[model samples]
Target: MGLHGEELTFGVEEEFFLVDASGQLVPRGPELVFGTEERGGELQQELIRSQVETATDVCRTAEEVLGHLTRMRADLAASAAERGLRLLPSGTPLLPKSSHEITQKERYREMADRFGAIARSSATCGCHVHVEVADRETAVRVSNHTRAWLPVLLALTANSPFSGGAVTGYRSWRHVLWSRWPSAGPPPMFVSLEHYENSVAAMLRSGAMMDRAMLYWDVRLSDNQPTLEFRICDVAATPEEATLAAVLIRGLVNVALRDVADARTPVIVPDEVLRANLWRAARDGLNGSCLHPESGELVPVWAVLDELMAGLRDALRTTGDLEFAEGMLARLRSTGGGGDRQLAAYRTRNRVTDVVDELCV
Candidate 1:
């Protein structure tokens, strides 16, 4: 196996939209990124001025990830408050956004010039988990093991129930919107390292991606790091929820690393089954059913969670994250996933702004 079992350290990247006191989208945000960076944070500008991203340092434990996430979020919140702005931690635009200016980087400007409408409307935020791997080929291999679980993860963090003052019906309208990008969505099963590289080359030729660095796949080999980055989740509603996703993913990586060492075959489900499952998860969130990643039978999402935790039991205990992971799941159960929580708030006063107000904290 390429990756050492103990070397699968992880980190989290979260993107957020800038907003105002009344839960309206704030159009400009480079100052917010700078402000947070000045405060000793790792915040950076996203594609648009209305969005910012925070990337955490590589961490060895879920607890460490939680601390980093909490600190970075608080730093950004402080920065936003200083400018009388707020942050909205969801997938879709929470309100009718004002005009957005692209971030002033040449690459970003080029992206805007080429992608045009998609670039303009693609301020959708997400949570990305990066788990260290031995090499690019190993990252490609582990993805075959990890892609099956993406729908469940997406369901657990489906935070975009409404968009632009209208109920979107789907829990993750952001997922629906993001699907419009030519290069975005689940990664294809690759036969070998050559296969992966050639496929990426083909995407560039097709203009589906601007560069190797612009892979918008659910899981991809990091171009700049020795990691497998999972991008199948909405930006979680809270730090706790994000931590749950991160810990579970790290545990899964641990298991996959072992499986790779033993030469176990990676699970490969049909593409249609994978797409349908994602659709169901984005539609139903945790309130309904999704197809089992392997068996292809519809079952309660909680039952899949049980199966997942059972598979992850030993790995989590090894990391001393079993109890913390369970507690976070319990919190998800009590408060429901982000979509359920947002729907509950929207139901309370029949106002989408209330949902934004609640998330602002």
Candidate 2:
């Protein structure tokens, strides 16, 4: 019953793929970070040898978000390049040369063993944005309201449209692949935090999950942190795009909090409808259309996002993030999502390497 409204804050986590000079996926993992540090490199707390995660300090204003994100991305790119690697933003980096090339971390190894090919196939990159709430109640409320907006986020961020040496059909094959795990998918709507916790507890007791974090819902409460995490986005093709995504996610949370506080009950579509919307986002990416939350009628995905932005303009102004949000949407509309670029690159070059080059550069 913890639905008390609260002011919002922000955090960001960006997962990047390591690429060689030729723009091929490199299994450098966190070993790259370690190797760099051993050689007087300057990154820390990375997730794997080939992948590094950057987390921003909690931010209050959108300016602070932009400032911190820009600095972090530049630093990470510089450090990674010094070690003969580049960071590519994508969901999965065309699968490794072999599954054995997975990250060397024990946890990663165990994940591969437990999840089998699904884990091995998860050489994906993503950007996860966290918005802070005053308490668990507000967090739950934001989470509930937030799910309906996720497919649009996915459509905006669509970047991974291919896998291995073949076209994967769906714009974000990684979303489908990532959902292969038993616990992966949208979270069911629960009436209270207690109900949510009980569901997680039942999964844990049944030996289906390791902990709360592994629930792997499109959006969920961070068990170890005081925020709701949205993981529906693909890794962006550029640091600027990633920053834009972080800004939009932060803005959405503030708007959701305001709506809840003002007695505007959140409108979430049925789970099945949401699933269909997500599939449409993956299949069509930016070129695809989605169902409107209220009318259940098909609307151009970008048009729906435009309406959402217009609706949230007041909240954006109140949070002083309106310009940043608008600017980001402009870029998304012009450049399209990651999957759009990948498709374009594939059209011209007829090679996945070309797509990787487009992704990194």
Off by over 4 Å in 1: 1-7, 37-41
State the lDDT of candidate 2 residue by residue for 2-32, as single tens digits: 1243346777777777778876666665665
lDDT of each: 0.86, 0.74
Flag regions of model 2 displaced more than 4 Å.
Answer: 1-7, 35-49, 95-100
lDDT, candidate 1, at 189: 90
Residue 83's lDDT within candidate 2 is 78
| Location of the lowest summed lDDT over 10 successive residues in candidate 1 | 1-10
* lDDT per residue (tens digit) for residues 25-110 in model 1: 77667877765654333677888788889888888888888999898888888878988988889888766755467888999999
The per-residue C-alpha lDDT of model 2 at residue 183 equals 75
